[model samples]
Target chain A: MADPAGAPCVEVVDLHKRFGALEVLRGVSFAVDRGSVVSIIGASGSGKSTLLRCINYLEQPTSGEVRIDGEPIGIERRADGSERRRSMREIGRFRRDLGMVFQQFNLWPHLTVLGNVVEAPIRVRGLPRRQAMELARACLERVQLSEKSSEYPARLSGGQQQRVAIARALAMQPKVMLFDEATSSLDPELTGEVLEVMRGLAVDGTTMIVVTHEMGFAREVSDRVIFLHGGLIEEEGPPAQVFGTPRSERCRQFLAKLLH
Target chain B: MGNWERLVWNQRNVLLDGFLVTLEICAIAFAVAVAAGLGLALLRLYVRPLRWPAIMWIEYCRATPIYVQLMWVNYVWPEILGWPTTFYTAGWVALALQSSGYLAETFRTGIENIGRGQREAAYAVGMSPLLTFRRIILPQVLVTIAPSIVTQFTVIVKSSTLVSVITVQDLMFQSQRLVNVWFEPIEILTATAAIYILFIFAVSAAGKALADRLRLRYGLGT
Candidate 1:
């Protein structure tokens, strides 16, 4: 087993992001230990999604830095003050270790289910077509979707599509996975199916960072849970410490509303 | 009776010849327009330095009337440069450019309409922008933009009629010759209009069938 404390898998320091006049994230700082699950529980508009986006450099931070396994994810300014953004190719190479599953399940409609799973592996990683297809088949099997591999994304239910999205990401063989409210857009029965897959991943020690409103899932799956409110991390600890014992009035009030 | 037989014989061959010429011009010009339009759209989307220039070029071509553009390219560029290019080549070049402007905008819109999440999803999967665009974006764009492109192609076919002014003996030019000889203005003009309408109708039907097949195959409509 890898030592958990030696080196963090991801680190964000003093992260700040603003959209025009709207300040979304302010001085956010956190780090995720390897092989652990961290759940970010936040109300809507609390910058949780933006925080996930910032991790992979999908959304550029206004001012701050993120390091994924010690690899810088954002732009750097030179001595002459010329700002240099990473080329798309560089970003693609860096992003190979990081997979993000979206709430909307953003699966490519033009591709069949198997094609979606195999696309990145074959195109970006230059995997052999047969090898990529084999990997894709394995991922679909993991998601319990191998039978539906021939179907297109549109033919699947919301839950099934989200699972396919997860399989697509898994086909890349990522070291870390980010779930931005992966079940938020799903109906209850559909949400249950996706949560089951996530739970299975956690048991297998897949390092994951998830943003979700499913408190029950938070209680069940997370090793650590952080509540983000008003563009800042309000409280964080082990799930029991944060959920069982109340410390802040804000947390209490937030819990009360959620419980009701 | 022999006069009627001769009229039928003469008109069918003449119209067939005219149809072949019209198809030839449309095929060449449409290929040029699609290639140029896709190149311009990619430049605009990916190269920051070229974005404004690409937009300006598309706008300039789009804003100018096609007839004026044809006339200018047909008469002016060759005269100014002292090039010995043929009128047929000049006419096709002008039509290709004008059509490219519109097609570029169509491609750009198709690219942009793909949600930001789709790009983020692609990036998160470790696919490079080129791979993402080629495998993911361009395929979707084809499905999304095909209808508009076919519509524009139909328009391009009709617009090929403008080549008559540049000395290309296309359908409308043949119709004019027939009118001048027979002195039946309304009949010849109506016949030309009917032919064009039939071509447009056929193209639209083909486009619809293709779109439906794509939707069924890809499940995009769902």
Candidate 2:
């Protein structure tokens, strides 16, 4: 269901995160509509990854709200009508709505490609083994790695491993997909292979929030580009406006550095 | 010369019998140690409220000598607690308790050795903490620590000698009895040492073979 403002599938309100004495996210906020691609770009340590992590509740926000499908996640309204952090069990239920891909392609080393893809379905979702395997095979085909299903993750190349990771998330069929620098660990030549799978997902209207440093992909793929600096939204708009006009000094400087 | 050979050959059955009992104790104690060690490690790391209790148990068990622990469990615990425990029961239980602390340390190391990335990957797919531990974290940790665990088991077997002090009639106890009966300390004790060496070598080789098989199966690098 849509919120009063719009049918935003993902919403962040005044997110603030602190790691010990240091603050990582300072009053950050954004929204992503269903079936739209939004790329969040920033310099390292600007909290781009933390922002994506907060949305998926990977890193709990210090203060703020994350709403998925218009429902507040990882939080409960108290008797006095103030939000408090939910228990881990409660947060876990909400987490099922989103799928995330990571920089390291963290596929289970001992499990085969198909086994990695089907693990959550059988264990978390309690799907029968045959059904999970069938779904896993389909996901592998989507990522163009059906032939690699029996291979262990360690046996696959970096790009192939990342694709298997994507298929793993796809088998869950989540409403929102959060990518935390999914290609950052890969070599430049390998990054394109993973980006290609993501490009296909974007064309297919998957609701995605990508934290990336790839300027060309960010400019060409995202419906909107968000530029973050010092843990705040420096600028945000359609790719052309954000990329062309550059509203803020931080955005201009960040883009100038990224382009080169 | 013929009498020495006859005595050595005759004692083989007795040694084999003692070996079975020793093996049984090892198998049971190993199972108990793994379960308790895993629980203790989990308590120290995850169950924050029980951290002190887990730590205290691990430290207490690790600090005291195994032979002393065996005597306490066999001779003192029953009287103090007004409970009855056979020497055999006391033997394995004490062994399980003492080695469990060492095994717990290994488990803690294995658990911490896994990168946060594996945990996040499981969480990303909406896995509950329980599921993550069951499916992802524990399995990898077990594989990572298997060789260490096998080495620990070897230590456990060697320490099985201490069970003789509690009068459980394990291999060492049987060897001592044969030495007394035959009046041949050098002959029978030397044979006992040989037996231990043979058993330990078999165990280590089996452990290496298991590791090799797992390495191939998981495609783990050298």
True-contact fraction per candidate equals 0.85, 0.77
DockQ for each model: 0.69, 0.74
lDDT of 2 by residue, A76-194 (tens): 77779997778887887777778889999899997899989999889878899999999999999999999999989888999999999999999988888888898999998999999
TM-score, chain B, predicted structure 2 = 0.94
User: Among all windows of ten consecutive residues in candidate 2 chain B, which has the lowest summed lDDT?
Assistant: B1-10
Q: How does candidate 2 score on lDDT? A: 0.88
How well does candidate 2 score on lDDT at residue B48? Answer: 92
Residue A101 C-alpha lDDT in model 1? 95
A86-156 per-residue lDDT for model 1 (tens digits):
77677778788888899999999888899999988998888999999999999999999999999988889
> What pairs collide in candidate 1?
none
Given candidate 1, what's the lDDT at residue B137? 84
Question: Which is the leading candidate under TM-score?
Answer: 2
